[model samples]
Target chain A: MTPSREQKLWMYEKMLVSRRFEEAIETIYLEGKKPVFNMAKGPIPGEMHLSNGQEPCAVGVCAHLEPSDVVTATHRPHHQAIAKGIDLKRMAAEIFGKATGLSGGRGGHMHLFDPAVNFACSGIIAQGMGPAVGAALSRKMQGKPGVAIAYIGEGAVNQGAFHEALNLAAVWKLPVVFVVEDNAWGISVSKAASTAVPENHVRAEAYGMPGHLVRDNDPYEIFATAGKAIAAARNGEGPSLIEIETMRLAGHFMGDAETYRPKGEKDGLTLRDPISRMRARLIADGDADEATLDRIEEAAQAEVDEAIAFARNSPDPDPADALTSVFV
Target chain B: MTNTNPARANERKLTIARAMAEATAQQMRLDPTVFVMGEDIGEFGGIYGNTRGLIAEFGAERVRDTPISETAFIGAAVGAAQDGMRPIVELMFVDFFGVCFDAIYNLMAKNTYFAGGSFRVPMVLMTSTGGGYSDGGQHSQCVYGTFAHLPGMKVVAPSNAYDAKGLMTAAIRDDNPVVFMYHKGLQGMGWLGTVPGATNHVPEESYTVEIGKAAIARPGKDVTIVSLGIGVHQALEAAKRVAEHGIDAEVVDLRSLVPLDRETIRASVAKTGRLIVVDEDYHSYGVSGEVIASVVEHDLSVLKAAPVRIAYPDVPIPFARVMEQFCLPNADKIVAAIETMLGRQTVGEPS
Candidate 1:
């Protein structure tokens, strides 16, 4: 369960990359639309959902995924998309609506699809559950290797799709794992207001599957829990559900004024930022020295910068080309 | 008959239920990638007998009897299809679609398009439809029109045992997401009773009837009787009944609804100069309207008399057998509608 020196460094670097990418997206997403707050006027128009502080959830689970393994993610998908090896330049370009994008600008940030790394996502909550279960079933049926990891938010726990998918995965004994990233906020609503249960993982017991709850948004804890579940699936064992407590460092969407938030509630989330915690842990755990960690952080930010620059420089798609991909 | 399997060489007359199960068994034998799943589909062989003897032949892993969780299993079929397996997942009944339509329309239908063709969902969503035995509102329905109305889905339903086997074969072989809807009334299941003549001589071989094509069940020059599913049976009977009135009626079986046989419909209407659509689905905003619109859109001048539609009334099918029968389209109703369309019925005559 312990992360090796290299694994810790890898997780730390990935967290940094995810953080910087979200920071860049958040900035440019609000560029032209600010002050006047016109959502359609930005370089990245329409909705921008960023997974800022929830870096550990994606990094830990994806660390277990192979190139052939499938990963279906939620709307705030850049983190998982990056962690699962989506082409950075193309993904950034997709968010920018450029022709060089992953789906040729058809699917924006929320609807990212990268079959190269076997990654797909959508704006709908709990929609990924079905496809992930299916992918697991397919691989098993064909005697092919590789499991599927489906990521959803705690809010999705209440959805029938989520319940149905979990029960199917368990009953079929498919090679799949359901990861619930409990950020505790579904837009303005909190888990206390929306969820009837105190935890989503225990609900997996209702379906005869083992469920684990990872506290503190810790990457190492997530990695250990996800490692066991993923290995079990790969070894022909049944599926498992993991609920990781995480934080939303940004608003649900860019330009969302959190006026509904109680006073000082927003400030508390910044104190538990996973990236900052990971960097300190990496130093304290003797995985890296300050100099080594500094180099990794700088390199990660440089990669993010290149991706953002590539997105900005990419060409816009022709309006006529919009009708091409509706069918095969 | 060209029989691929030597054992069934002498068997010519197969019911729609047997034809479907045989088609599935043949496909499974031909391709190991194809499998069947749904509640009661395994040992119970499905309520409508669509998967009869599948589990005994294919085993549990390949022919799974899933929990009554439509959303998960259907979604898994879509995922499995992308992973290079052809999965024929049953929704159990068309009425049960409400519990799992998101997986059907969103993932199964739109994923390939959303992925820009990077993924191919070679999955077949097969389910039982139609209502003649008073299964109540929740159990009986021919809602293939809803799937046909959506984009990125191939919707097909066969009227007889011969087409049932062929269409099921074709649907399994197609790369896109195909909704293979079958009518319960025409399945020839002894318990529910079958539409007479719904069972016919079907070859015991793996063959695919072309999707999006209509069949001329009967030909006439005076008027066209356009319908599908159980309506095809009713239309044929109506055509025979109307012949006594000296009004020859053509019968067109619309096998596929999404890639609708608009060409066949238009051609039949043109030849007959009159049209009467009989459908088991609801009247407004359904396949019946789509059939009429396709004809008029291509050429409005082809019709001599105003077209008429004999469809289920826009109401929940009542529980009582008599009340449900009142809402259903039948041969007599189709005959009455044809009489009115051809200007032969007197207002006082019993329809």
Candidate 2:
């Protein structure tokens, strides 16, 4: 029911990597586009959807997941993809549009398809729902010891596909967990304008499923909630929806001006950053010292730097081969 | 085209990306109602440098970054335009039009017609197009034909910086919904790498290059080559190589596709009596087909020889660079096609 100190530390390490990797991406995604901002003028062109402040939801939920367990994520998929244990270097290369990338540079940022770890994501809204539901169904039919997690954003709750997937998972009692990373704002439109309900977890009641809400971007609460939900799903009880009040620290996309954000909201978020809070919590609880945490942070930085370097040095796929993988 | 004159300092060169942003900035300054909206148009400057630096001047309210809700924001631009505001909305990639087709095809394109000339929808839907650096099918597409084919929407695709600024100004001032598609390869973006000479000497002052007219990019006498966007650059390269062989190939950049610059095509084809239509879109039901049709419908006698089409094969764009390049229209392919057409070389034999 509770994580050991080593297990908590492991979660910290994963969380640290997610944050450091995204920070690297933020810097690299802006490579030559600055002083004269051009999105198409960077190593990572196209849309860059970052999940900077939403690390806890991924690390907490994925700590209990295995390589065999299926995980489907949304457009803002960096944190979850990293936590799901997909190849970090390959992911960076994928974002770089290189030959050595996970999808051979085919999918780019939003369409990272790493099937080795049963991890994949899509760019469209609520696109991962059916795949998550289907993956869980196949596992159940084969009597396999695995579950599927459909990770979506608060904005995706309004999409009809999300509701349909949730109902299907619940009615069929599939081993799937619907995780909503509720970051409050969706592009420029707020949750208040988009959704009818105040909270996303409450909507799970409509599908005859149990709902759990975790607040404050707290990993402790998120881990507790996700543990029980996954335990139940793995035990063949049913599906549960876990909504975490995550933070979207950056703009909707990398270049977003964020004028729609309330004044002082970004500053407030910076102060309440989940990483600093967790570092403080770990020290206060006697789980880890500042020196140890610093070492972990340093190790994470090294790993991220190596991954980025690999992506930067990797050769681009031959333009003639773009037609190859369409079939097999 | 480079203006080689010391006194013409105002004609300093600019990229399609800078020219487009400059035009939007100028229009926004003149007209209070002229605003911009898209996924990353604000501080992040648009995905293709189309709205760069506007947010710092006009502030976020005017140079807004709407949520990724394309269906809502694109339709909102139409609604705002109908209500007396000029909104320049960008749909990130032209390939993303499927998710929000109603707002674009129905409301933005046909709203004024449906209202029976009640009100005008003076809006600009600027988007990125082209396939060269392997962004896969979604990010890399020159589907301006689809926009041009949809009756009410005026399709404007500019190849150089001069026309990029001119047509953007015209699109802003026009009282009809205009779809401005700028190819990524001609944007002078350093990341994807661009064709040399894509930048041109664009004048500082705002000017409108008349819509429905084509510009003679290069002059020749033996054959006429018509193309736009990245294809125009490829055509120019092909023209220079053929000139060495004494086979003249005139290049006509059909800047606006919707207005269908038939007059220019007819005039050019009439002069040379040989035609070649080059397009980055699919081979079927595309600009190439329409250009060839315009020539044939006018007079069957205009053709001294059978016309040729250099275009992407009918298939979804591939993500692998090798496959994409094979599908793309390039200078070598154009040269080979010309060589075969002129009987100087045989088919399937490299010149």
State candidate 1's TM-score.
0.95
Q: What CA RMSD would you report for each candidate?
A: 3.1, 22.5
lDDT of 2 by residue, A158-252 (tens): 88567767776776687989999999998999999889999999989999999999999998788889999999999999899999998999999
Model 1's number of clashes is 1
TM-score of each: 0.95, 0.53
Query: What is the model-wide C-alpha lDDT for candidate 2?
Result: 0.84
Candidate 1 — which residues are off by over 4 angstroms? Answer: A318-321, B1-11, B345-351
> Once superposed on the true structure, which residue ranges of model 2 sit more than 4 Å away at CA?
A1-328, B1-11, B345-351
Worst 10 residues of 2 chain B by lDDT: B1-10
lDDT of 2 by residue, B1-351 (tens): 222212244568888899999999999889987888779999989878889999999997788776566765665566456545788989888899888776688557654543324446788999888888889998888887788887778888988888899999999998888899889889987786877667888888988887777888888888899999989988988888877777889999999997888988998999999898899998998889999999999987978899999998999999998999999998888888888778795224224
The positional error of residue A262 in candidate 1, measured at the CA in angstroms, is: 2.3
